[model samples]
Target: GAALRTLTEATTPALARRVAALVQEAVRLRPETAGQVAGCVDRRLEQGPTARPVLLPLVTGLLDGGPEQVRAALATVLAAAGTPASRPLRRELLESLLDRERDPAVLDAVLHAAAAQGDADMDRSGGGDMGRSGAGDPVEAPYRREDEIRGLVHRTGLLLVRTPEGATLLDRGLADLGRHVPGFAARMARWLTEAPDDWAGMVGPGARRTIENLAGVRVPA
Candidate 1:
């Protein structure tokens, strides 16, 4: 618990990453301690966005080879930290892992992580049915600041839709939100409606196609 606390409490990004590396090393050298390490990592992740950069390398590095328990724990951390605010970081980590991660359990965790952020947004908007009266109005939900919307669009263009696998995951993740959160699709549409022209310029053609084809997302024209 001390080590976990230290890992999470590290104030700087470099410190956090260093602590994660040490935990990875510990997990490597002592398989029996995987649970403790994972627990610590999970706790740090639950602390929210600040832990993401620290947790990113730990999740990606450990995914390739580790005790099953260790990998599963890392996957859980990844899913929790996988928010759009983390954006390209989360997408980058997941894309790399999905390409090579062969463990079914680990892969399942990756997919689950991908949807975590979108689900969070859905919940914040209230998880009512889409056709439900309160569901479709963006005014009813918490507003996303311009910077947040920019980050989301940036990820959509630069990372999530850059590859087939990422595009698929992005599409699926949002769709899941729409299904579970109701009116989430409309809310997303409203959010994007305010994206500045520069945000559109940030997106590439492939990403535009993915957004159009899969989510029918409206972008600044």
Candidate 2:
């Protein structure tokens, strides 16, 4: 725990990565230390966005090369840190992980972390004057934001469909994202239909059926 705490104090990215490696080694040598390490990391992450810069290198280092348990733990830690103020950083970290992670458990944790961001426009619930027009009418800001999120979901789905394990988690994560962003599932269904060659052959029957059902797409007999 104490060793992991030193990650926050690391002055450079190199140093942070080194500290992260040490923590990983410690956890490996003393498996029981995993819980305590997670606790220490959680406390620092709870500091919110301010702690992101300091933690990013450490977290990235771990996610990049740590053991499965360590990677999963770090992903869960990022998910728990998900808040309106920290969503961007959390999304960035999780999405990056999505690109390279192959372990089913780690991917599951990353997907859950990404889904835990809730709605894309959630941060706008505070009613800021930033997106208003000269006539005090709402502009296309929210719709545009939703569109961006839809695109992100599409890209992420494409990545997830590349492997059977990832495909198994795809529908559930899409459902979670759809709960926050209306029409997301249907939109993704349309995307899949438009490009059948991209994912149709990659995912198994079970995942394809689940995705179709979730999106309300009919599979003709």
- For candidate 2, lDDT tens digit of each residue in 137-169? 664455555454445445555666667767767
**Model 1 ranges with Cα > 4 A deviation:** 8-21, 28-57, 80-84, 114-119, 128-221
Model 1's C-alpha root-mean-square deviation from the true structure amounts to 9.5
lDDT of 1 by residue, 120-149 (tens): 655654654333244443332233432343
List the pairs of residues colliding in candidate 2: none
Question: How many clashes (backbone N, Cα, C below 3 Å) per candidate?
Answer: 1, 0
Measured on C-alpha atoms, candidate 1 has an lDDT of 0.52
Each prediction's Cα lDDT score?
0.52, 0.60
- Which is the leading candidate under lDDT? 2
Candidate 1 Cα deviation (angstroms), residue 211:
25
